[model samples]
Target: MQPGFDDPVFDSQGVFRSVMFATAYPGRIQTLESPSTAPTPLSRAAAALCLTLADIDTPLWLDEATASSEVIAYLHFHCGARILREPGVAVRFAVLSDLGAMPPLSFFHPGDDAYPDRSTTLVVEVQSLTEGPKRRWTGPGIRGTLEIGIAGMPESFWSDWDLNRELYPRGVDVVFTCDRSVLGLPRTIKVES
Candidate 1:
């Protein structure tokens, strides 16, 4: 299998910081420059995220399109993350590649009010961040509102996101990845398309 992170410590830290910045400012796109490579169907940003965030204790879930043997092996070897087929509260991180067949957000862990940080963080593979329906985001990190277009999400995505928002502090957070670009959409943000 291929190795992960050219400089495991520094590279992972850099990726982690980029992810944090994205999470803090929803609708913002952050570029990642990881030296690691992932198997087919998984973008460099997504693979970098898995390597930076997942560990022996983390449970990761991969959607049908991202569960290739090579991808699984890479994650296992580099991240030591447990990959499960089922979507449940036990899942800490999820990688989604096929949006058309994406399951409802309710299927993944939402974490309880007391443990919201334990909820699943979704890493979605998309076509482009600069194309698609424009959506306005307003919430904690934005000055007022931020409008951004994200391509390749399913038709039900916004509706599901709305429902997820209704859950308030219990829903999942999303990170969109395309090539080496990444965008964040934390549950704390309000989205209007």
Candidate 2:
């Protein structure tokens, strides 16, 4: 089993705050010096997120790339979270090693109208993250508009997101993790080029 937050209380709180900040200020990159450790292809930021948000009650689903025994053991030991085989199941959180290779975005659970907040939250690892190939984000969290760039995404990801955006509160939320940085793209964030 791998080590989790050095100081469980403080570390979880810190990471939680950063995740909240990321969602509150969508498209803004947020960094947290995570005290969590995970298997390869998983970022520290994402590991921290798993430790912070996942618990016995929240079912966690991992992509094939990260469904290894080692990684599963790590998540189990640290978060005591359950892992499910299906992404479309009512999982509270899902972890994917490569966003570019993932299945259709809509394949995951999108909460229904009466319980939109029950949708899944995706934590994806990307090859790199930088600012360029600009995109405009406008939504509840943005003051007006925010321009940002992200790399290592699949070519059709933007189009998929466009369709997901149309679903309003019913779509899954996303968190892109790369190295030590984390960026959020909640269901409320609308993206444009």
Clash-forming residue pairs, model 2 = none
Q: Which candidate number has the best lDDT?
A: 1
List the global CA lDDT of all models.
0.89, 0.84
lDDT of 2 at 131: 46
- Tell me the tens digit of each residue's lDDT in model 2 across 7-91: 9899889888888998888887889868556677678888888888998889899999888888888888888988999976569
Clashing pairs in 1: none
The numbered model that scores best in TM-score is 1
TM-score of 1: 0.97
